[model samples]
Target: MAPLENLASGRGAFAPSSGEPASPSDGSGQSVGSGSSGRKRVPLGNSSAGGGSTSGNPAGDVGLGGSSGQPGNPDDPFILPQENASTLDKKLKVEVPMEIVVSCGPNGVVLHPGGYRISPGALKGKGAILAKELRSIVRLRQQVDPMIRPRPSIEFLVEPGGFDTYHEARRQTVISGLDWPVSLQVADTKVLDFFPGGRF
Candidate 1:
């Protein structure tokens, strides 16, 4: 634990119990004016054997072993320790892979290979004969073209501060002739496609 962590947890040198001040000593081997006020001056260091009660080590103070030590305060609010790398790795979610099929078809620009059935409201425009033929070719290639490998799926780490950027990028991938589907997974659960028409 650090000094700041001690402060945050209400434990460092400045933290006093019951709002009472910790008695301090003067440099001239004498008690401060706090003695006249009937306050007992707490020893800055551990006293000799059978001398007095102990308040434990202070933060950044050299201990009997000659190493700087952090004081432990049972009354301080508890702070959860940071997770180790292995623990964090076990808690991480895996990335999902998806496919985005784009083509100009009889139903206009197709964003998903599942056809208009997936996004009926989004399929607009009276496509020309050439567009219909293009759809046939695109379909044939999808079914038989062994050379056409699947495009790598896009990934989005669903953190609080990154949602807007991920949302905008997902929109662009569907509408800007980019043939890649977004991969979003959270806590081992796969999310459905909610941006097909790019409305949500």
Candidate 2:
């Protein structure tokens, strides 16, 4: 008879035998290494059930692929569209009144009511000189005038035939002197002609 230790060693105690098959079912009907027949295995944490993709395309996942509208053009749209020269003139033109006053004395010119003054030597042309005088008058009024209303639009009260020498070009140059959006009119103390004949 073998010693107890020899007998245990010969029978391979504490080691599993390779000849016996692993149990396919241990109370749970599924196999230890694979699923049962006719059953499909699914991976954990799939996103398909929520109607989205794992690729992370927000628009594509919602079935909106290529449906997003194009971006707006950065160029200004308010600019007037191009047209024939005649049409362009009609669309883009502005009118401002021309009023003239004459002071030939050594004391120079004084814009009455507003009291803004300019020198006789400063009179280069009827339009240019008068525009400068008007601008100065506007500045002084903005500073000292007590009226709380909007600054009054300028109107030229020319003496009779005072601006007869001013051609269209000279008139335009004078009109450019005032800030934009100003209303202007010209009159001879009785008859008035609003500039630009038509609405802007």
Candidate 3:
């Protein structure tokens, strides 16, 4: 998705970024993660039922489509969606670190390291998004973008502000004013390791 420049008016929402081709689903309701694709799809279902497992191996044999149970990274940091089988839209809550940059982007506030977007209007007052570690709930819509994979849309539970930080595009340069418009480009790309090595 695109990034934002103006925080108050919500202006400068850049064009949605080009998406990567996602692996085709075989109607099994089992979303699998590929080895090279930097993307992982955790199938949505009720964990209590005979549906798939939420953690460990998502493609377990008891799920909608019975398979050999493909293995997934045990150390994966993401908390896959579960407990809701009614819709393709799901929410994944994550705690964002101050080290990762933030800006007004898709959803509302976009976090770096992963281009995770927050729900619109979730953030309260904001000078710069990277003031501290934030608890955010990310909305993930699987069916929205057919051409590309789904990215996390976040909604912060706490407000971020009252801290001085550098501009979005100009690294090491402090923002003249707290209310100045911040762009996604102002994010420090050098420190963040995004998909494909950089460029989120």
In order, what lDDT does every prediction score?
Answer: 0.40, 0.43, 0.36
Give the per-residue lDDT digits (tens) of candidate 1, residues 68-164: 3345444545645568986665456333334443332222333344443212223332333222433454456445644343334434444333333
Per-residue lDDT of 50-165 in model 2, one digit per residue for the tens? 55455543343453242234433335474445579976654454433333333223344445555555554455446576666555655565456333222434433344443432
Question: What ranges in model 3 sit over 4 Å off?
Answer: 1-103, 125-130, 134-200
Which candidate ranks first by lDDT, i.e. highest?
2
- In model 2, what is the error at residue 126, expressed in angstroms? 10
Cα RMSD to native, each candidate? 24.8, 12.4, 38.8
Between candidates 1 and 3, which one is better according to lDDT? 1
Clashing pairs in 1: none
Residue pairs clashing in model 2 are none
Error of 2 at 58 (Å): 9.3
Off by over 4 Å in 2: 1-41, 44-46, 56-116, 125-153, 158-200
Per-candidate clash tally: 0, 0, 7
Question: Alpha-carbon error at 174 in model 3, in Å?
Answer: 8.6
Q: Candidate 1 — which residues are off by over 4 angstroms? A: 1-91, 107-200
- lDDT tens digits by residue: candidate 3, 1-200: 33442422333333246544343433453323564533655545535345445553445465333454455444545636446653442323322222335554333555564676544443433543333322232222323333333333322222233112212322211332323233334233432332255433
**Cα shift from native, residue 43, model 1 (Å):** 13
Q: What's the best-to-worst order under TM-score?
A: 2, 1, 3
